[model samples]
Target: MSAVPNQAGSWSTLETPLSEPIMETLGLLGFDAMTPVQAGAIPLFMKNKDVVVEAVTGSGKTLAFVIPIIEKLTRREDPLKKHEIGALIITPTRELAQQIHSVFSTFIDDHPKKDQLTLGLFIGGTTTLAQDITTFNQSCPRILIGTPGRLEELLTRSQKIVNTKELEVLVMDEADRLLDMGFSQQLSRIIAQLPKQRRTGLFSATMTDAISELVRAGLRNPVRIVVKVEDLTSKGSVQRTPASLDINYIVCDPEQKLIQLVRLLQAELNDMEGARKFIVYFATCACVDYFYKLLKQIGDLKPFSLHSLHGQMDTKRRTATYTNFTQLPPAVPAVLLCTDVASRGLDIPDVDYVIQIDPPQDPKAFTHRCGRAARAGRKGKATVFLIRGREETYIEFLKLRKIPLERGYYRLEDGSVCDNVLKNDDAEDEKITTSEVEDASVAPFIATLRAIVKKDRDMHDRGMKAFVSWARAYSKHEASFIFRLKDVDLGRVATGYGLLKVQKCPN
Candidate 1:
């Protein structure tokens, strides 16, 4: 049912069974020891047994699946036959598919048969179908890495472009994200096209009902390996993201959340030196856009460059942003404001911090989001900003699930939250009253503010000053547009932000 990690074995253990080429490549790649997931899953994978692994992001799950597939391909007597796709690895996002492909390419580069056993990447928007077809026709790559939609599109466009019958291994990376992104239909269609008699490996950051159901249907007698915190809590244990990760949360009014987030970034840059990478997760694209704009204009954030990513951005821009952020030089502060799109499987190096503006709907997502940091045994910190009253339930859920979390605070020069907000005369003075709304002269402006507020269900009155400040900068109308809004309309927007009846009204 499950496999325990074999502590005694390392990559060297495979030296006797695997050809010298694979061993030499592993050595060159500087992979000496086996991650627990690798130790547990690789043995089953090499035995031609199907595997379903529940491991966090950046846990070396990519290589666990890649190495065995490469070894199988290399052991084959004949070179990759015409149009044969020896191994197919399907991921949910183009970035992840590209990342995995890069890793595969590096390993393949060191292989003796690098030219014969090639790797191909197929993702939408990155290349034209005709171009992909030509490349496939010329080399007929033995290893194929791609997202579901692009792979499905290619299959429908060309009948024999991918010889599924010749595929020896089928891998689904981030299987949970695939299901969450509503790719189940596309995944089902792709699976139907794949050969039934093949080794299938499904890997995900968490085990969910959908993943379990897919495992039951897609994999036969799969060896299951689920890595838990307890598995890795012991020093020297190999499992999941390192226990060195620091988890914390800061409770604040919904409106001040973004301001506080900016404060955290300011603190990081002020206190630390050298290259630092930070990922801040928002609940929606609207939140990400607003925060990106706010961060660009506010505070002492000018020194650090900012990048925004969401589902709406075109592939080229998203790729460019990812490249720029990941490759930043030392002493440069790089920050990525994104939705869950970046949370799943992209392995960005040297990420020093991860901040969640709001608690994720699923507790499991918190683990993966934080897993982006503390990678490869490096120390990192993860913080979640919670609205004082609303987030207690989510925090409780996290605690009940046994996810580690610490209470956090901002040590600003002015004062702490307790001294500033809880015990200050200015607290009531800063509260916005609902009756203070100035009706907008134009319907379009009112409508625009309503649309923006509707997208964010977590906004509150405490944040109105910040919103107005952002609105004034955003609309180019200065203070006139904000004053023009009817009190009722602004109140409606505040309600959308999760403002309560008893709270202070907008000023």
Candidate 2:
């Protein structure tokens, strides 16, 4: 379905101003209406103006900058001649770089003259320097997406092969993160190598002092665009978070947080009409790991499987867990415990609920966590858990940030699900016990485990050893219980199905 805007300042509304080819590509991408950030920034960009956009994740910020770059790069005077690197997109992480490159590749794939254009991804941890140099020498892509460190290295080592003198556009995605990660000097060095006269864009979830400095030095008379949360509350507005999402908060005692989370998960898991897929956020990896273990030990919560994403885990384990949780069916309950790393630029579909165990350090982080759900206009729920005493502080912060949050009630120790919690709710001791908790059927749980291994097989041609390794690493159950079967030997069945080999597995 081609997007036809109903009013002015919409994507379909901008159709006449954009070239036919770009509009055709957008139609294929299913982008009918323009996101607020996109509508606010794209017109200025089309006129060769610099822009600094501060929009939360999943607010179409990517396309807000990407479309303009595409338009500028494709409008070259001589397409028949060897294409030069027209646009340079600098990202903070390898995953983000790959994601941005994938977005660019999608449009390029649909272009009429795709053979004349190329998109390159330069990031560390996957390829060697020699391989990168060879690719650069053979095909200096017309559009380049890469991390700051690797891009700087390539510019210094392969100076002759990689040219930026004619670079028409430059973009810094997640500029705040880059600055927070101490990439100021490296970003500066890379910028020093770029052409002085070019349209620039700086996009991030937040605007800190460091980001402001970057904007001052980087963009020229840039137009600043901020997509506020209150905009979503406006009637008939097409800006900010989708109206389908239910944004709420829950206040509890610090000591009772874990029990409160358990109760919420129990209610959601047992309720006939509740979301099955959930993403729970925490302040630290230790908290995530601790809570993941606690949930695994709770028999009542057995219906819901758990996955994790944090900086401490090995890259292989982290990637595997991400793939599993993302692929798991919504009917089979799954919860992904993660930190800020999973909050940005990572799109996980069908997320029914997003729970923040603690109030996020800032409003931008809260918005990104909520963005994990209610995507693509789908209805979802987001809840924040605040300690009793700090409720007022967080509430004040939200008010100052102009974030719209509704109070939500949850089942408390008093056996009543209510919205109000006193500042010192834990004055009396109440221990939560699971002794009487009933067991949910294991059919769905077992099937979810098998489904993960099956998806891994579909993605890679690995043998049984790999499956066992992943299962062992991912599941908290003892190896025997996780792989046990009533009729057929689980090992034999797996081997017969090409998911396992006859080698002795690790304990």
Candidate 3:
């Protein structure tokens, strides 16, 4: 029943000497044998070979590379000697950087071994470069982990990393994210600053084209490890976010989505679980700021409003927002209104629910957003609301996975489970998708867009172009296209064509 995979996606024999504390933490966290992802990726790291790990979320990826890093700390002479930055870890967001650092720190603290190594967290918004430079000057910290921008800046501006040549191993935690943030160019630049002899490690939930190019650019001939597909985490049947969840979808007018969001927050205030940590996912920075200001004005909700943590926020403010959310108490309900930027790397352990104020970019991103709720074996909930007219997407989502379409308690106010949801039942007969096919899951959505464009459509037959544009844009901003009737209308036929179908989600 454990979510951890053994090897890539299979099971693993627990033979490696992962710091004693990590072993204890695994047991504490309810892990037995290594998960498939961990099993496959660990050996590559152990041998100091560059690695690219592709597995689903929650597959015990943190330890896959951390063990090798720790083992190297022991293999090297004078373990605490900070001659140079021995290890460098880059993450997309401050929250994720802190989370990876914390997990490593926790392992080190608990491990009966590894008492001599000194690890330093070089992050922006709080720890100044001067302080890190001084620490490096003192020459005590062995490992350096930080956000990409800050670390890249430190290497260029400070002589500490360059003088010591301590950048021995580089680990990119959210490899796909780093690629998505358009850091491919930045990563190439940063890697150039370091010696080319170091080992590289990459971990991601998905292997995208940009990420594949990143591996080619960053890693040498590397060990390609794949896990069992069954072990991979995937989309939930009814809830986009599974793991630990009880989701409820509400229906409302497209224009009233924001109103629906506020109403959902109101519902959480009275949940008997009394959990306080929450993240409201939006599709755009404009929505984030708009909701932030509107949420800030609400005085009686007993919730703390967190500002925009998107690309627009300065590193300093972004770091601070991350701090307040993770470190602050739940005296009042803490609501972080954020764009998809915070969805991947950040970890807020106590979060009981993730209120997707807006729909997800696609099924893949939707599941990832819901994943923010449940972490480290904890249960969580995700709710996505669509107005009645737009509800047929329910069947479409479930059909893509071929999982049971059981209708849960997410009935409409009128007590109907399949009410008004559009699904294509005949879509499967086309041989592209089975009859059980539902709305486009994450991958299918992207593939659908690509497929539409692949076919040369009539220049005047906007049927394909409009649908493709709508599908692509919908993957970015669902609400943005609510009014683009041309694309929505076209997509109903061209995007999925015969492959598209509408159906209700099973309970």
Candidate 4:
């Protein structure tokens, strides 16, 4: 079953009304109406049905399951004991788990029965297993939220302290990512331990054959909820991304990628009316680390606050970075250089732009990466950087998947030094093509980067690592036919990375 694209029903409109506390909390949270996903799935969940929800990111998938979990627990005849878990929410990443926990806390903290219902977070990066066990025993949290590895360990090891005999709901948020991250074994083990009679909800942005297998095993005869985006311009076309999101792509030489990125950031920073928050995606963790350092040293980008996050970072640092970026003030211009770690289910407020320096290894991730912006019906823009030759064919690959793209243009006033381009045209026509902008900015920016890297040993080593890792990652892209490693211009790529020499990439 699919939700109507424009459905925005009130919380009270469900067949079974939610408790006063939930309704009151929803009002306080400024959620006066439910999005289509929430409106469609919440009623079924309330009626005790297994739901497989495939909706775009930032469509409020969190609260669809969250509200049902809270309502079902509150309506239970037998109150959950301190040690008994009423609901278990497993997501692929610690940052996403933390986000869900924060949402639950917002409601529970305002509820009248807040003392009776408690929430516990058990992702194991910052805290040890012993600490989690201690908290579980002492707090007797009724709801549990965590990553697969930590959840599997806690569920199997601490049976006495972690009771699920009364478990009512099992939600796998980002179910596709859970499978992508190779958590099938962990998910299987966790499912075997849970009560077979519980309500199961598997939420994801996209559905795959692997996810289908998981649904068969984990969920009962499930009701599939797909919330599709209607293309406003084309009557019969349905898009994977929100209509509010403006997705554009720029084609540049391999060597011009970095300077083009800097130019875009400069443009966003210069636009006084635009939100200063931006998310820039890199191909690998090494790239995030290298660029995070490289961008910090650039004189032009110094006005923006820079942060880095990747899957390889420790739990504490990743969580801290996510929190800091989400809480950044609208007045302060900031950019987050990250891997797909921040792409899936994060809802950073007022994100004006999402810049993709590298296309994701998985094509489906393109939707999620862009979904980070233009969320909750808000207007946002995303631009992906594609190299000029075979890599440019990726645009067609995405088009086949119902994701349309528009050619991106750069404003001449975006600090481009290209004097050859016309400067006296109308405002609409003053924009320059990617090549013109790249031609003007590439040589000087590359020289400056090389000089900076030559003087700093750490920067030199980081550039080499990032280049090697990026090449390997490209080789493994799902669309190998289009992103063939053999077609890459290694010398130009090295120049883009500010490397002293082109290094050999590992097979």
Q: Please report the candidate that would top TM-score against the real structure.
A: 4
Cα lDDT computed for each candidate against the true fold? 0.71, 0.68, 0.60, 0.87
Per-residue lDDT over 228-312 for candidate 4, one digit per residue giving the tens place of the 0 to 100 score: 9988889989999998999988877778888778878887777777658899999999999999998899998999999999999
Tens digits of per-residue lDDT for model 3, 406-436: 2322222222222332256554323212111
For candidate 1, write residues 347-413 as lDDT tens digits: 9888989998755555567788888898765788898875443234455566656675766764343
Error of 1 at 54 (Å): 1.0
Q: Alpha carbon lDDT of residue 479, candidate 1?
A: 27
lDDT of 1: 0.71
Backbone Cα, N, C clashes tallied per candidate = 16, 2, 46, 1
Selected candidate, larger lDDT, 1 vs 2: 1
Show where candidate 4 strays beyond 4 Å.
2-5, 410-438
> CA lDDT of 39 in candidate 1?
77
Q: Could you give me the TM-score of model 2 versus the true structure? A: 0.74
Ranking by lDDT: 4, 1, 2, 3
- lDDT, candidate 2, 110-180, per-residue tens: 78766555888888666777788788767758888998888888887775567777888899988988998
